[model samples]
Target: MSEAIRIRVTSQHLAESSNPAQQKYAFAYHISIENCGREAVQLLNRYWLITDADGKKTEVRGAGVVGKQPVIAPDECYEYSSGAILDTPVGTMQGYYEMQSADGNTFQAPIPVFSLVVPNLIN
Candidate 1:
């Protein structure tokens, strides 16, 4: 079945906030979630699998995003920005959002794997 929600991401490296010497790479990501189904849905939780360049993995689980559980109506969208710190300059993030529809049906809205790379790192 097609997903009722669509997810998109845009990421940017934070140079000033990152300490390369300490292997601390910081990136800010903006996520937009659009509801395409006929029913409205409330985002209940999020689960993320983050992988660093060395193949190290970290799993993050939490309630809501940016401190709010947003309710999105059909054809509407919700957007939020968050940050992640990694030991490598390049990494990937993929995960899913747990959602509850108006009728009390729960489902997973998958967020596609997205890259986080420092500029000029892959020339």
Candidate 2:
């Protein structure tokens, strides 16, 4: 039921939290997960594939987000903010969320690939 879910992402560079000289780049991403279906769904787990400008890739897998597995109601939305650290000034994140419907059916909601870039770094 891919059409039953919608995922949106926005990101910002945390300059204060990053040290370019030290090869540390920090970025914060805000996610909005909307349940467009008629049934409620619970987020079970998250899988992320982060790739930096240098072609370095890192994968992250965890239970829930922000320490909580939230149940989103029909036509409702759940939002959260989280950050990632990279070695380069630019990166991209894409993944999916494991979701369980009220009827015990499990499905994956895709997270669109979004950019993480430091301001003025990319032309």
Candidate 3:
């Protein structure tokens, strides 16, 4: 059986550098996961295919996001936060969630790409 997973991401500015000489930015993202399926689904693992504007690709594999593999029930949702470090100011991010149903069937849900652009970096 195939299950559907829904996720939403919100970027937050946790802190900023005071010195003008410092060239760096850190973005904290709040992710919400919703199980819209008819049955409970457990988030087994996660795969991140992060791509920068310079074509640099970074793949992150882990057991769970934010140290919790939440099992979302039908029509239920959960939220978590994470951060990423980038040198440049402008970029985008997209990835997938690997989830399995109670019957041990696995499926993937696509996470939409979101922009991360600093005010001064892009027009």
- Local distance difference test values of all predictions, in order: 0.94, 0.94, 0.75
Tens-place lDDT per residue, model 2, 11-123, is 99999999999999999999999999999999999999999999999999999999999999999999999999999988999999999999989899999899999999746
What's the CA error at residue 117 for candidate 2, in Å? Answer: 0.5
Candidate achieving higher TM-score, 2 or 3: 2
lDDT (10s digit) by residue, model 1, range 1-123: 128788999999999999999999999999999998998999999999999999999999999999999999999999999999999999999999999999888888999999999999967
Residue 67 error for model 2, in Å?
0.6
Which ranges in model 3 have alpha carbons more than 4 Å from their true place?
Answer: 1-3, 14-23
Off by over 4 Å in 1: none
Q: How many Å off is the CA of 16 in candidate 2?
A: 0.4
lDDT of 3 by residue, 1-123 (tens): 333677889875435731224645667778898888889998878887666667777788888788888888999998998877655565677888888898888887777888765665444
Instruction: Give me candidate 2's TM-score against the actual structure.
Output: 0.97
Off by over 4 Å in 2: none
Return the candidate ranking by lDDT, descending: 2, 1, 3
Candidate 2: give its CA RMSD in angstroms: 0.8
